[model samples]
Each structure stands twice: as structure tokens, then as C-alpha cells.
Target: MKNKPNQLKYLKYQKNRNKGFSCRRNFLIFGNYGLKSINSGFLNFKQIEAARKTLVHNLGKNNKILIRIFPDKVLTKKPLEVRMGKGKGAIHDWVAVIKPGIIIFEVKYKDYDIIKKAFFCASQKLSIKTEICYE
Candidate 1:
């Protein structure tokens, strides 16, 4: 771990910012990777981090994991005891609009069985549908 990039891309750019850029990565780097995201929905930054934590724990110190998507869109939520017909809710949390084909995460490990457990734990932390895949 010599040089790790700490840059996080700006989001809240949900309005007409679709320039057809490839946010969802199709190809993978390692042989054993955890393929995720079958359905489309909002994925928060916390979810991404939690999933990565699980992957790292399972992969140990040798393997690598990549997070393919980022949460750029903002989500709103209404407070409790709020009346109806409100204009809009308050800004709650940030999220990325994940699609069906978008790959959320990819991981590589020696033990294949542990990979499944890692992905399963990660998927449980997420709010959308996800699957584990390999090379």
C-alpha cells in the first residue's frame, strides 16, 4: 500500500449530468471477484464502505477489492410527525442511482467459500439486490 488515491468524486449531480460516462465497470482486474447489483436502486456511501470492510476482512492481506460505483445522488426524507402535502422533504443522505448492470464491488481471494460469505455479508448491508461473481 504505497500510493492509495483518497479522491472521492463529487455527486449531487443527478440533474442532466448523464454524459454517458462508464460509471459501472464491466471488466474486472483479479481472477476471483465479487460481482454485485442485480436490481437498481439508491446505494449510500455508508453501504459502500461497509461492504468494502467485509470484503477486506474476508480477502485478508493478499487480495484486492475494487468499488466500481459511487453514490452521487442526494436523497430526501421526511421527519416524523410531519404533515402531508409538503412541498418536499429535508435532505437526508447521499446516494447513487445503481442500475441493474452496474457492478457495485469486485473482490479477489484464495478461498472461494470465504468469498461467498464476504459477499453475502456485504449484500446484507446494502439496500439493493446484489450477487457474487468470479473470473
Candidate 2:
């Protein structure tokens, strides 16, 4: 599923400069195991979808997966070989401004080994480094 919001207060947003650790959503709340990010960056919808697909495919359909972050930030991109001074380009994609120590994905499962393996495969699809944390 796409992670974009249906409506927003404003369309475009400025580039994020805050790189500090996350104060909220740093701990597990919805599930027993979670995938926590170790670095700060932007997570696009495609990357999120890939990771989610991997998790679901590997973990089976019975397990429940909860995504903590949403790609609500709008990203603009100018067309290639275009001249400057045309305001901001058209909206391109949506992304989530991720901070260190923020949990990305949470899963409720019985087997620890299977959960670890699924998380490892999912982490490879993301741009940021991640570690599995458990409650």
C-alpha cells in the first residue's frame, strides 16, 4: 500500500535539517519485536513497500506487521536539462524523515529466529542501517 496521506495542511515541505535522535516512537508499543533505525535519512514509499513486502513474504500471512512511520513529507523534483528560476518543480514522491532510534516496523510473532531472519531480509531493502529490537 502507498504511504501517502489523503490530504495535508500544506502540499510541499522544506528540507529537514534536524538529525537528532527521535524522542517519540523510539520504543516498542504495538508488537513484541521491532526494526529500529540506527541512522537519520529519508525513507521513500517504494523502499518502505519493498521492506514490507519482504517482511510479509518471509513471515507468512498470519503474522501482524505494524508500520510506525508514514511518508507524509512531499518531495519535489525538477525535470532533467531544465533551466533554473522556475520556482519549485512538480511534486515527485513522498518520504518520511527518519531519525536515529526510531522504530520502523513492528511484528508480533512466536519464533525469534524466524522474526530475525525476516527482519534481516527486510533491512537490505532500506537505505538506512537497522537492528532488531525485542520487548
Candidate 3:
């Protein structure tokens, strides 16, 4: 994928500014670190909602899964209201906080990069291992 000129410049600046900055921070996966494949809403609600349910219902072989529902878009760190769907529905880019003792699995249909960032970010913050499970 071609990089946007402005985004490229900003990334370059960040790279130069933080020489000692390590990619590991407790274990926070910054999903918005890079460009996304189209947008979250671009995908069909049915498909997205199905994926969300699969994440929660499947859970893990042993680890407990906790799904966070956001009311609106959250681009950065800030206390915000998140909405959880009743049955089968989409959680608009919801940030699922996989608590301690639970290995987080970030599931994505197409956005590998976004999933990776989220996985990494979660890993950094939660001090737990995070894995990317692509659908």
C-alpha cells in the first residue's frame, strides 16, 4: 500500500524524535498506528457483527474474553462511553480489554496491520501476551 505523503511525514518525524522509544510498552497495541483497509464502517454490518459475536462466543479454550462496546469513534486514549450490542450487531471499532490472565486475540477480517497494532498495544498495556486471529 502506498503511504500518504502527510502520514509518511508524520511517521518520519515520530521515528526521528523518539530514538529510545521501544515498540514494547507493557503491551498496548495501537490499532490506529497505521492506515486502515478502507474504514471500519465500510464493511457490511452483518459481516462485522458476525465477527464480533464469534470473538465473544468462541472465547478461548480457557482464557476469558471481555468485549468493550464504544458509543462512538475513539482515535486516542480517553475515557469514553462504549455501547455493547444486544444480539448480533457491530461494535464500532470497540476496544476490547482483555484482562490479566487472559490472552487477548484480536480478530479482524481484512485489516492485518490494524489488528497487529491493537495486539501490540494491548500487549504493552495489559502486561499479557496478545495474538492476532484473522478471519
Q: What lDDT score belongs to each candidate, Candidate 1 first?
A: 0.68, 0.94, 0.31
Q: Which stretches of candidate 1 lie over 4 Å from their true place?
A: 1-24, 29-31, 78-89
Best candidate according to TM-score: 2
Residues 37-90 of candidate 2 have per-residue lDDT tens digits of: 999998999999999999999999878999999999988999999999979889
TM-score per prediction, in order, is 0.69, 0.95, 0.23
Q: Which candidate is the best by lDDT?
A: 2
Query: By summed lDDT, which 10 consecutive residues of candidate 3 come out lowest?
Result: 34-43
Candidate 2 lDDT score relative to the true structure? 0.94
* Residue ranges of candidate 2 with Cα displaced over 4 Å: none
Please provide, for model 1 over 67-130, each residue's C-alpha lDDT reduced to its tens digit, 9 standing for 90 to 100: 7776656666679988897566766786766766566777656777888887898888898877
> Stretches of candidate 3 above 4 Å error?
1-109
